[model samples]
Target: MKKLLIAVAALAAFAAAPHSASAGPCGLPNQTTLWIDFADGSVPHWEMFAKPGVIGAAANFIYPPRLRAAGAKTVYFDLNFRNRIGTPSDPEDAATVVDRAHRLFDYAAASMDCPTPWIALNELFGAGTATPWSATNAQYRANVLAFVRTLAARGGRPFLLVNSKPYTGGEAGDWWREVGKVADIVREVYFPAPSIHKQGAVLGSRSMRQGLRRAAADFLAIGIPPSRLGIMLGFQTTPRTGGREGLQPANAWFRVAKLTALASKQVSGELGLATVWSWGWGAWSDGERDPDKAAAACVWLWARDTSLCDGPKAAGPGFNTSLTEAQITLPRSVQCMVGAQRIGQYDLARLTAMTRDRDVAYSALFARAAESERVRISSERILAAERNVILLRFGGSTSAYRGALARAGASEQVGRGVLADELRRAEIKRTFQVPQPSGTEIAAYYATYSAALARSVEATPAAPWLGGAKRGVALASIAPPQVFKLPTGRRTAVRWFDGIYRVRPLGAPKVLGSIPLAQASGPISIALKQFARTNAFQSWTITQQKAALRRARCARDELPHVAEVELASYLPFLAID
Candidate 1:
């Protein structure tokens, strides 16, 4: 009889395993918390379906015994949210806000049989802080502080820092802003934009490793340690692409192991918890389009090489291949085929059948490069949406924006109008300290910002090829040598690169190396044919450098489920390598 152990978590719990997510940190902690997000973060209503023991939605909540075995001490439930259209400041409005929050708390309490829920509110900056809203900055800050204090009495952990453009709230920008005064665990969002056009690319060029680095830097600068901070990264974008909302690009699973691996060395040790944005749904969310494929990847990311030997053995061809290779028909396909990215000798019949029936992988990189594209086809759209929201609220002649303000007990948009008025006064009185440019100037200022936003959206595949993913394809063909030796005359040495491994020449800048997609983990290997120096550090770089295109193009089927507590709740999602 096979002894089986499974672990899986819902959207919210930050799983902190004792050092391992495929030889790193992606494996969730033994004790997992169930989180419910109120935003439309790519996946909608994931909690209702991510229950433990559920099939299609496998890797639900963890079983109590396994958690106890891990010697975990606590169980948690948290609700994630942002302000309700900017916190109301008036006594009447404030009362209504408090009442509504109470009702939500009551509903959450009744809905789940868990402990007292914690609250995580994003964009904690007052209304005046970020956008030109009706509330004054002081009023906005006071309201947020008050509301948070109220929730703190009932276990609320607000997102004290957020990465909003032009403006930010919470601890990162909280210099004298004082948002941390009313907080208990402050979380920060470190999202990577998916615009990969300058080089041979597919999704956003920003790597998971880079995002975490930036996250760590931000916290470090603010004197905040990882113990008090939580990082929120996304497995997929919210379809804010091409000025259209609700687009699912299925940008493969880029860095599950690598991210965990890097987090182990970089930021994971001190962090209280790390979370992926969603559990997603249906057969379209990145690498999770297929249950079996996703499950296979989940197991690998969760337990690394252990999963390869822990099973009844995969019953299929290419047993030596990794789980991703075993599943993808094309040797280097990275995502499901939505449209033909190649025109040459393709296994059309196989491709066709797979496209219609299964979650197949194709090269979004090849297509984007050929189409003069880089990574992140939707990054611009996300920015545009933000700009559009601001413009619509302040400049657009829309009924919804007007009605929203009117309902907020104001005939005009007090926040937007007042801010604009202040800017105008500043321009007029240099000594009196009033801003210049009233009506036309204010409208024009926003118009220019809006135009820039549009230009970004129109700037599809951003720049020219940068000689990496494009000129580097042939380099990948160099078959991987042994872990420590070169093959015969082959000068190339291969090492896996999920952005976690090193990718540079030792002691010298002239040594040449290339990283192309290996069947599963694309490694960065160098050929120091004549220049191989003694004591030159057998391997080159070890830290995740720039975001690699190959990283975004491989479907790591053996990666773990993003739903934090998932992997442990069910049988290993997949037992294949």
Candidate 2:
């Protein structure tokens, strides 16, 4: 933590702060606000909170049965007064959102005896690189201030949150201080540390909280008070029913809850007001059909008991052994005070080093010697991906960069970051080689096309998984099932055959677990053989396995040999009976 440029005097107080565990959940108080990401979902299912907590709705136009229920508490409505990524210059449209948010707040307050009623705004922070409403960071900050002032003029509680880097779009004003005036609290949500995961050193499910802690230090250094900031516990990796997705450790929910509590402590000085982003997204994009329930239950764990979320004091000796070099950026705690914030020219170099160092750590778990050099080049690639993401957000852009991202496997966060970094450097180098006009053209090409290229690299299933048998080989070749290695962590995989999946300990024959076709989603293939005649069935799957069993009735000739299976995710294996 070498740098002290951001705020020297104020941060000096943090020098002696001990890293002891908190006695309980950071005591964030009534600040826990629930959320309904979109208005189009089912009747806001507040039951999942299972206990008393805030329920936030992004576009809850009308009051509902739950709000009227006895003992119902706080319900926040996130404002969508205007198109967040649409035209940036229109102050009127932005004003409309402020006005509407106020109205929504008033209606809820008036309709029920709710204890706390507030309005929040998020996601207007556009996707990709642009700021809210597709405006520059400065413009976005001003717009937010404008909205805040509007709400303050009439006066109830109004808050603002964005899912971007700390202080990204809001620094145009006094940033921390000015916005703090009108906002109930100014907030930026930090979700999964895909960056940490990309580093591969954060380790186990518990370490994901490391990103939140780092981001918290950054936020504090920049002047956002602990009382005002919040972190939304989000999933960087989507959950699926089969393959690597299903292999997610069962303790995932516990890790998230504990991290949420740990992260809450990071920002809350004595004020004890760290907010955990909750409420839920409308539905899972992958289309898993878990009827009567929202397909993705990712955010469900945020409202749990905070006491259990704390990481225990080292029970004994080995607790601190595996700390990765990338975990702590600078040597001393004071240096990190300033080290956390990336200001001015220091932003690029500092961030690049940090990003590259982390990826190098991840390389140990995921990369081989032959690819080590290319892996080291991750810093440049990520910078390019960043630039490309920004350009892709430019007006008139469609999914033009999708093809390139596919080529680079950069659609994922880690890939997108590397490609964005690479494109940025290329633009700088090109500016010196050609005329300004030509360089500008080249820069555009790099930003747009290069980003897609990065996405393609990550999306490349084969890079993550060495080549394995694609389809069935003769059963005779394997009198007994042969041993094959399986990658671990998110990349770890297993193979599905017939109705059984063979999961092993990497290369060992010891079976770790078994996943039958009954629990799988999507499709499977099969074949049934009776006597001299054999019939191949492409559509046979778990859904039909039971009925087939009933008809066969287990008679000798009637019993048919089961054959074939479907495989997904990047599991390493050979085809088998």
User: Cα lDDT of all candidates, in order?
Assistant: 0.29, 0.33
Model 2 per-residue lDDT tens digits across residues 288-396: 2223222123223332332211222311222222222213223222211111221122322333243344233222111111112122344544444344343423222
Error of 2 at 225 (Å): 1.9
lDDT of 1 by residue, 33-78 (tens): 2222222222232322232321111111342223323332122233
Q: Best by lDDT, which number?
A: 2
Q: Which stretches of candidate 2 lie over 4 Å from their true place?
A: 1-45, 53-72, 79-81, 84-102, 108-116, 124-140, 167-173, 184-207, 235-271, 279-281, 284-303, 306-577
Instruction: Give one clash count per candidate, in the order shown.
Output: 56, 54
lDDT over C-alpha atoms for residue 379 of model 1: 35
TM-score of 1: 0.35
RMSD of 2: 26.4
* Candidate 1 segments exceeding 4 Å error: 1-92, 122-134, 156-178, 181-207, 237-266, 270-577
Query: All predictions: root-mean-square deviation over Cα?
Result: 30.5, 26.4
Question: In model 2, what is the error at residue 236, expressed in angstroms?
Answer: 7.9
